[model samples]
Target: MMAIRDATAMRAAVADSWHRSAAAGVLAEDSCAPVTVTGDQLRDLRDAHPLARVFPLLDDVLGQAARDCDAIMAVSDEVGQLLWLCGAPSAMRRAERIGFVEGSNWDERLAGTNAPGLALRLGRPTSIVAAEHFRHSVKQWSCAATPIHDPIDSRLLGVLDVTGGDAIVVPQTMGMVRAAARLAESELARELLVPSRPDPGTGRGRIAVECLGRHELLLSVDDGWGQRGQVRLSPRHSEIFLLLASAPRGLSGDELAVLLYEEDGGSSTLRAELKRLRDLLGEDLLVSRPYRITADVTGDWLAVEAQLAAGDVAGAVRAYRGPMLPRSTAPGVTRLREGLADQLRSAVLHSAQPDLLSTWTRSVWGADDYDMWVRLRDLLPTGSPLLALAEGQIGRLDREIGL
Candidate 1:
C-alpha cells in the first residue's frame, strides 16, 4: 500500500480533489470501483455516447502509442464511466486489477481521485502521480487525461486517458493525450460536415450564450457543420450578446445604447463595439439594421426561465447557477439579472421545497437574502436536524440586521 501524504503537501488540484473525495465518503485505504453498467446496458450506453462517433479516431491516435509505452488507454463518458479500454494484454490486465475496466465508474466521488475523473471535473488536461491518488490501491499507477468536448455544442463529451507508471505522467504524454482529444474533436467536426447527415436539433444551428454569474460571457456557436466552438467575449460584447439574445426580434442602435451605457453613449462608440463584435462573430451571425444573432440562440438565464415556465421548480432551482452577470452594472443586464433572481426566488419560496430553498439560500446571491433564510427555516419540519441549522442561520442574520 502507498503511504498517504498530508493534504497540505499535495498539489492544489490534487488536494482539493482529495478533500472532495473524502467528503464523498471515499476511503483513503481502498475501495472497489462499482461496475455500474455491463453487457447490453454497457453496449447501449457506448452507442449513445457522443464520443462513440469518433471512437475510431481515438483508437487510431492513442492505441499504438499506448501499446508501445506498455500503457493502457481508457475512454470515459462525461460521467466517468469507462466506455472502452485498449492496449497490450499485459497492460490491460494490470489496469483491470485497479478497477479500470470498461463499464466501471471512475468518478472521483465513486472511485476516489484519478486523472480521468479530475480532468472531467476541471475540464482540462490533468496528471495524477503515484500517492497523489486518493485510494491506496490506485497509488501505484500514474496517468494523464484530458476532457473532450462535443464539436457541435461545446458540451463535455468525455475524457481520454493514458494510465501506466511514471512514464505516463511525463509532459510528453500529457501533450499527446491533449492532442488526441483535439484530434477526436476534429474528426467529430468533419463528420458533422457531411451534407447528408441528419440534423439532430435546432436545424438553424444552436448558439449557447453563457453569462449567468460570470463577468465575461462564453459564446458557443455551431459552425453550420453542426459542430460547435467557444469564444470568450469582452465584458461589453458579453452584455451585447445577452441583450441581443434576450430580444430575438433585435434591438435598434438607440435602444441598445440606452441599455448599454449609463448616459450619452455616442453612436460611433456603440458602432465600434458592434463592429468589433461583428469581427469576432463574423458578418452573417450578427446582422446589421437591428442587431441580432441569426441563429437559434439560448442563454443560461433563459434556460432557468424555460424550466420555471414548464413548472419544474426543482429543475429551475438546479439550473439557476447564480445571479446573471453579477459584476455587470449595465442597465439591461442589471434588470435581466434582478428579474431572473426574483423569479427563481419567488418560485422556490412558493414551492417551499426544503431542498430547493436550502440550495438557494446557500448560493452567494441568496446567502444574504433574509426572506429566503426565513422561508428555509419555516419550511423545514420541526425536529428535523436541518431545522436547527436553518434557525441558526436566521439568528445570525437577525444579529447582522439588528432585528
Candidate 2:
C-alpha cells in the first residue's frame, strides 16, 4: 500500500530543510541531549549524596522495553539515532543484521534515504522498504515507524521502529511499532499524567498493570481460580507481550509474526497456536484479524499466539511461567530461549546511537553494572587525559555541592 520512489529529490529536500533549521537555531540542541544521567551520576548519588536521590524511572522503563522488543524492533528519539535494538549481537557487529551498521543516522548520508527519517518527518507511523528509501546504502533495509504520543493529551512523544533485511516487510511490524509506543506512552503518562488502573474481569480473572518500582511495568495476573503465579514467558514472548499489553489499538497476524517470529513455524502454524492460547484462556483475548490483539480477546490458542507474536511480550512472558517446554526441554525451547535472551539484551545494553562507544561501554559495564555508572566510567580511561579531566570535574562537582 506504500510507494517507494524519488529518494534523490526527497533526500535533497530533507537536507536543505535540515540545514536551514540548524542555521536558524530553530531545532533545539537539547532535544538530542540524553533525557538521562550517566551511570556515574547514579553512582555519585549512591556514594556521595546517598540521599542526593535522583530517580531513573524513565531509563529503567526504556531498558526493560528494549529487552522485551529485541527481536524485531528498536527505539529512538525524534531523530533516527538508535537507542535500543534486539536480535543482533551488537550494533558494531550489525552491518549484516540491521542492514546498516551502528551510528548511521536516519537523517545522515550514511542512511542516505530511509523510512526512519520519513517517519520522523510525518510524525506518525510510516514504512520504507528496499529501493523506496532515499539512500541506496540502506535500500536492502525495511523499516516501520510509529510516533509515540503524550498520554492523556496524545501529543507527539517520540518514535519507535522496526528494521532489518527485505524480510523486514511484515504486517506485525506495525504492531511492534504501536505496541512499543504504547509502553512508552504509558511511562510518559505515569510520570507526567495519571496512574494506570487495574482492569480485571470475572471469567478472564484479574489483570494488574502497575509501574514496576517507578519505571518499568509489572503485569501480574490472578485468575481467581488456580494458584496465582506470575507469567514467565521467554524473551521473544516478553517483547511480544510488552507490545500487545499496551494496545489501545490491536495488531494483525502477519504483524505479530514479524515481532515474535511466529513461534517456530510459518504464519499458518502461528494462527493455530493463537487459537490454542485463546481456548486455554477463555474469553480473555481480542484479535485485530489481519493486524493486532489484546488480553481481553477470547483466548483460543490462535488468538493467544497472535497477541503474543504481535508484541505482547508481557503476556507471553507471564504465560510462559513454566518451562518453555513444560514436559521436556526440546531443542525448540533451547533455540527459543537463546533468541529471547538475545532480544532482551539488545534492547537494554545498546545506546540510543548504538555507536562504537556504546558497544564498548556496554561490554565493559554489562557484565556487572548496578545501573548508570558504566556510562560514567566510559568518559575516562585508566590514567588517560579524559580520565584526569573527568576526575577534575567530579572534584569540582563535589566541592560545589559540598560533598
Candidate 3:
C-alpha cells in the first residue's frame, strides 16, 4: 500500500482535506467526481433550488468576465453538486476533461481537495492554486470560490466559483468571487424579505413583471401547473400594464391615455395599444370597460415596496435594481419610479446597515448618490475596508459638484 504522502508541506486546510479524502477512499491519483444527478433529475433539482432564482444575476455579474479571462464560472449546491457552468467554449471544453461538468458531485469526500469543496467544507471563501488539489488530474487547474448563504435564515445555499489556469488564483480573483457571492445573497434576501400574496381562490398561479432597468419588461408566469415561462413586454404595453396593475379599480381608456401619453386626446392610439396587449395576455386577463388584469400580479417595484414596508431596509436596497421603466416618459410611470426610489433611499439613509449601504453605493442608480455616500461614510467603522471606498466615492462626487 502506498503510504499517504507527508502532508506537512501542504496548507493546513488542504492537508485536512487530503486526510479526509484518503479516509473516504478517494483515489487522488486518477479519481473523478461522481455524477450525482443527471437528465430530468438535475433539471428538477435546479428548478426548485433558491440559487436558480439568482443564477442569471451571477451570470450577469461574473460570466462575461470569466469568459474574457479564459475561465469558467460554476455554481454548486450546498452539497457541492455543480448545477450551472458558463464561460468561453474552450474553457468549458477544458473543464469537462476533469469531470467538472454539471450534475457532478465535488464534495470534499468525493472530489478531493478543490476550491468549491473546500469553501463549502469551511463555510467561507477558498482559493486553491495548482497542485494544492489532492486529485492529480485537477492539479493543473486553479480556482477561487465562495459560499453563498440565504441572508434570511442564514442557510448555506450554494457556492459560486471561477476556475481556470494560474490567472484565476490571484487575490483579485478571490475578491471578485467573494463580492459576487455577497451580491447573490443580497438578491436572495431581497426575494425572501418580500412575501407575495397567493391567489389561491383564482388559481391563477403567480405572475411577476420585472420592469426595473430594462426597456422591455420580462413577464414571468407560473401556471396552475408546475410549468413556468417568460415573455417580453413592449415599452408601451409595460407602462399600460404597470398602470393597470397599480390601479386597483382599473383604468378607463381616457384615464389610461392621460397617464400613458404626453398629449391630450390620445385615447384612439391608447385603444389600439390595449388591443395589442389584450391579444398577448389573452382577452380574459385583459378585460374591457375598465381595462385591468384579472389575474393576481406582482412586480419588482411592488416587491421593493413590500420589503420597505416590512422594515427590511437591506432587502429593499437589494431589490431596487433601478428606476421602473426608465425609458418610459409616461407621467404615471415617471412619478411611480421616482416615488419608489425616494422611499428606498430614505430608508437606506435612515437605517444605515453598512453591507446594504455598500450595496447601494455600488449600484448604477446610487453611484453618484452623494447623500448616500456621505451616510455610508459616517456609518462604516473606522477600520472597515469599505470605509475607503465610501470616502473615495464621496470625494469623487464632491469634485463633480465642484466642492
Candidate 4:
C-alpha cells in the first residue's frame, strides 16, 4: 500500500521524472509483476473479439515484462472486450472492457477518446501523454500505439497498444509501446504472408505476396529473417520468393530453376524451394504449376489488371507493394518501382473515396510523382475535405525526405 502511494505521490510531485525514467529505459529493465484480471475474465473479453483466435499469442506477450513497465499491454477490438488480461498479474480480476474496443463508430468514437484508441481511429500511429486522451477514463494514462496495416491490402488491421498506468502519462514508456506495436505488426505481416488461407476480401489473389512486408518479414519467408527475426532465406532463396510473389500466372519449374540459378536446370532445387515456401506459407501459394522460375511479369500483370477492372480497390493497393523484385538488390528493380508508383497514382486518382486516395498518395512518394500528386490534390472537390485537407499534404512531403 505504502509503495503504491509513495510511487504515486512521487510521480505526481515530479511528473517529469517519468519522462526521464522512460528515456533511461526503466521499463525494459524491470520484471513485470501481475495485475488483477482472471483467466476467465480474460476469456470473456476474448469471446467478444474476432481476434480471439490469436489470443494465445497475446497472452504470451503480456506474460513478459513490458507489461509491468508502468502499464499494461493489451489487444482490443473497435468495440468491447477482446483480450483484456494482465501484462502482469495481481490485484484482482474484473470483467472489464476497454473503451477503445467498445463499439462501431470507428475513427474516434472510441479512438478519439484515448491513445491506443485514437491511433486506431486515425488509422495512423500516435502517442498520447496525460491529458491528451479525449476521454476522462483514459486521460490519466499515457499511451503509444501504431496502426497495424494488413500484410496484403495494407488496410488498417488494428492498433497495437502499450498503456502506462499514471506515470505512463509521462514519456518513459514510449519506446516500449512502440516496440510492442512493431512486434504486433511483424507478427501480422508473418501471418498474412507465411502460409495461411487467403481471404478474398483482401486485394491480393488467393496467392498474393505483399511487397511492403517484403524487406521486413518476407525476408524470412524467403530465407534470413532480416531485422524482423530469423527468417531463413539465403540470397538465392530470396530471389525465388520475389519471383513467385511477382509472377502473374505462376511460373514453371524451368523458370524457377532459372530464377534460382539452378546450374543444370534440374527441377529438383526448384521443387525443393516450392516445398519450403509451401511449408512457410500454406499450400495455396501455387496458382497452378509444377512451379516455374521465369515469372512472366507481363502475363501475370493481366490478373492484377483484372483485380483493378473488377473494382477491387484493395487488390489495386496490394499490387503496389513493391520495388519490383524486392529481394534482388538488383539495379534493374528501379524501373519496376517507377512503373508501379505511376500505376498506383493513376488508380488513386480515380478512386471515389478520399481516405483510400489519401493512403495511395502517401504510399508512393518522390519527385517523379510530385506534380502529379499536386494535380490530384487539386482535383479533390472543394467539398471533399480530407484529414490533411489534401491541399497542404504534398508541400509537407516536399519539405521532408524524398520518400
Cα lDDT of model 3 by residue, 1-403, tens digit: 1235768888899889887666555667754566656897689668878899999999999998899999999999877889999998998998887889998878776677899999988998998999888888898999999999867446577899999997776789988999999999888877754644543444455668887766767787655444455667888888988899899678888888888887785667788889998888766667888888877788888999998999988567656657888888999888898999899888988885765665566556786889888888898777554454566666667788999
TM-score of each: 0.56, 0.32, 0.55, 0.43
Q: Per-residue lDDT of 8-111 in model 4, one digit per residue for the tens? A: 44424223333322222222112221121236534543464435544466556642544455355656543212244355432112112333222212233112
Tens-digit per-residue lDDT, 1-403, candidate 2: 1123333455554444334323322222111211222344324323332111111332343334334444245544433444444444442244443344223344422233345555666676777766555434445557777776545434343456666664557787666566656766666556533333544434445444432111222344555444243343433343444445544476566566655553454877766666654544343443445333433422222233454457654333223221222222333334444454344334333433223222222232232332222344454346331232233334444566687
Clash totals in order: 2, 62, 0, 37
Question: lDDT of candidate 4?
Answer: 0.46
Ranking by TM-score: 1, 3, 4, 2
RMSD of each: 8.1, 22.1, 15.7, 13.4
Which regions of candidate 3 deviate over 4 angstroms?
A: 1-206, 222-229
| TM-score of structure candidate 2 | 0.32
Alpha carbon lDDT at 351, candidate 1: 93
Cα shift from native, residue 36, model 4 (Å):
35
Clashing pairs in 1: 151-228, 152-228
The models' CA-based lDDT, in order, is 0.80, 0.42, 0.80, 0.46
Q: Report residue 195 deviation for candidate 4 (angstroms).
A: 11
Ranking by lDDT: 1, 3, 4, 2
**lDDT (Cα, 0-100) at 388 in candidate 1:** 45
TM-score of 4: 0.43
lDDT of 1: 0.80
- Give the distance in Å from residue 114's predicted Cα in candidate 1 to where it truly belongs: 2.1
